[model samples]
Target chain A: MSGGRDRGPDRGRRRGHSLHAFRAILAKDLRVELRTLQSVPAMALFGVTTFVLFRYGLDRTKLSGGLAAGVLLATVLFAAILAINRLFVAERDEGGFDAIRLAPVDGTALGGAKAAALIVYLVVLEAITLPVFALFFLDSWAGLAPVAGVLALADVGLAATGVLVSAIAANSRARDLLVPLVLLPLLIPVMIAAANAAEPLLAAQGPAYGGIGKWVGVLALYDMTFIAVGFAVYDFLLED
Target chain B: MKVPSLRALSIATILCLGAGFTLVFFYAPLDADQGFVQKIFYLHVPLAICSLAGFMIAGVHAIRHLRSGDPVHDARSYVSIHLSVIFGVGVLLTGSIWAHASWGRWWVWDEPTLVSFLIVFLLYATYYPLRYAIEDRDRQARYASVFAITAGAFVPLNFLAVRMAQSLVHPRVFATTSGGLPGSMLFTFLVCLAGMALLWTCLVCFELAAKSASAKLSRLRRALEGETYAAPNRSRIAPSVPSRAASPLT
Candidate 1:
């Protein structure tokens, strides 16, 4: 059955709210995650630890330009991968996919829900990590706001890709290893665009908008492509 | 369902390869810029183009596989990617040799084309392990198709991202202007490209034919040997060709 968007008078009366299904699934995930305190806190802790490691590894008191962007975005992306790996675990082990298949709602709801949930985790990730990164390295908070904007765009793409990849790996034997192995290469463009966009913003001189537009455009393109892809292929990936 | 016979394809391949090589070394004029070393372009560029093309072809086949649930399409898709990865190895080696010859380094991050190709290669490289990690044959084919399609879509976008990140800092190694390639060099490059494309197609056919034969042989063995016969390897990653005599699930 087509998702709620295409239902008509002749098509059927039993069709409405793929949106409702998406919301319910997303709410369930968020509630479970909140109650258990599983993913975000660990990801936040990982982010703080990574920033500490970067401080020692780069051996710089303050950071800017490519270095700051690399350290910050890479940390967020890796932490996103952590969340991504576990995204479909409960579904796989607990027959959530069967529930989705049995429901009247469209299968894309699961992917949409998962991507929405992952984006939430990423936003929370940036919230915790950005302040710590600023305290540890940034001389001014001026660049932080723009970096967050670039990161938000990157997160959409990451979430779309992460959901699709997580679904694929979730059924496999080595789900943990397969997630990063398959995901990191896919995330390279995100890294390239996000890091480039953030670089000028993170410049040692202070925030600059110069050339940020191009990278943002790239991030937007990457997000649109993956979202469209995940939406189109979600049904097939969820098939019995 | 029908393919050109192996003899015809091999003959065509040999002829094109021979003529392409001859034209590259003899007929094509020396580059005014890089000179002798530029000849590697005929080899490297074609290999890169064919390899990328093969990947997109695999994606197309994957789309059909997902839609039709045909293991034949999956087999075709698998062989296309398998051959492309092999060709990718050639692309990297030739590209590296060219880089070394021209830039005096085996690897350079500055060249966006090289870097993009490496990223594409790296992404597709995971196809094997992804297939191996899934034990169920049908699920493996299904997931592998998803990977192929996603990675295929990624190729052009990855190039765009890598190119934008570099911002044309790469020394234009090919031609300064869009149509600037001289007629003679263009002719030779076309020949080599055609040859490489033929070689790729020929390899795909060879691999598919080999896989089909082996699948048929196994099916025959099971029929003759009956219940006592065991599959040689239950954990094989490659898709077993679904011949008309055999059910796809088998």
Candidate 2:
């Protein structure tokens, strides 16, 4: 994005630089996150704490099937909501939107970067919290691999939809409240797909991968749909 | 580019709905399984279909609004969603009644269609807060359009996901009701569906026309009574349609 600084009347030619702009924004977001540690640590802590709460709330030290999947995904989803709400705060507060508007770079680069950044946050969050959940609840780690797969697909969908919603809610009053209210309903499909897919894998006896393909397909469809919609509409959202 | 007059639309709505209810009671055969309670199906199914269609139509209008930067399209989009949400209320109420009658429960998470409708309704119900949260008129409309389009796309996917999540224990409602409806039942259902669709359209027209009149009245007040003469109780969240003499709503 900084390379746009010297462009003049030939700025229209810079349209080809969206990928570079996307990378720059992604790098900047990562660098800021690494320095400040605002989102990931909080999300990880929230996820872990949620597991502890669920352990007590459900009164189940050893969960399996749909109950286990529900407990795990619900924690992950709410934590992701925390990350999503914070995704666009820096831009909103520091005049980053004006900077993007003035830059010759494509506006959608911001959305792409934010989503990528969210996916990173979710991955790091899952990495930390999923282990804690397993240690606290599960008797075996055999299903962890496919459970991770479900979580991975769900993270992509969540990130895409989250970033899109974050952009919208970031500009409104009571934005914090708006994000979850508008977003939770939207994320139901993701929850359904992920939970159902993870259930059989999280079964009490052993992990079974049956019927996982279709749910994975649903998650993939959800990711692509939101990513495309977010890309298409981010231009309008940023148009002041 | 003229819309039917509100009175004419209202008449159509009444005629269709009246004929539909009459057909439901007088013509359609009683269900072998669910005798009288099955009648709610005629009302609930049509409302659900119309409400879902209205949401998708709002998405189309939202697309046009974004492309044209026209408040008229935004108005249409808003009214479409707004009226559909009202229809959604009817859907839920009647659906609950049907469920209570059939399953002996007021609600059933096992039923994919009912659950999915609830999800869609909850999502669109947030539209009001989303619009009110944004103080900027132009920004509010634009963001709401973005939301409308996103939620519209979500409707079908939600149904698919929820349906897949349904367990095998609860047989599908249609399957239980029998795979095919008899001729008389199907005819009655078609009339009710048409009636509900017309009612939705009439409501949209009614809302848009009311909004247009309010806009025009405010514009006239501004012109005659000076800029400082602000009307009390003017809604802050409602998108104000530009008062053009030849507006399609008029």
Off by over 4 Å in 1: A1-15, B1-4, B167-178, B244-250
Q: What's model 1's lDDT at A22? A: 92
Model 2 RMSD in Å is 3.4
What's the TM-score of every candidate structure?
0.95, 0.94
Best by DockQ: 2
lDDT of 1 by residue, B24-83 (tens): 999999988789999999998999999999999999989999999988888888888998
User: What DockQ do you compute for every candidate structure?
Assistant: 0.85, 0.86
Q: What is the Cα-based lDDT of residue A227 in candidate 1?
A: 92
Best by lDDT: 1
Model 1 chain A lDDT-worst window of ten: A9-18
Candidate 1: tens digits of C-alpha lDDT, residues A1-240 = 666677574244333457788999999999999999899999999999999898899899899999999999999989998899999999988999999988877789889999999999999999999999999999989989888999999999999999999999999999999999999999999999999999999899999998889889999999999998887788888888
Q: Give each prediction's root-mean-square deviation over alpha carbons.
A: 3.2, 3.4
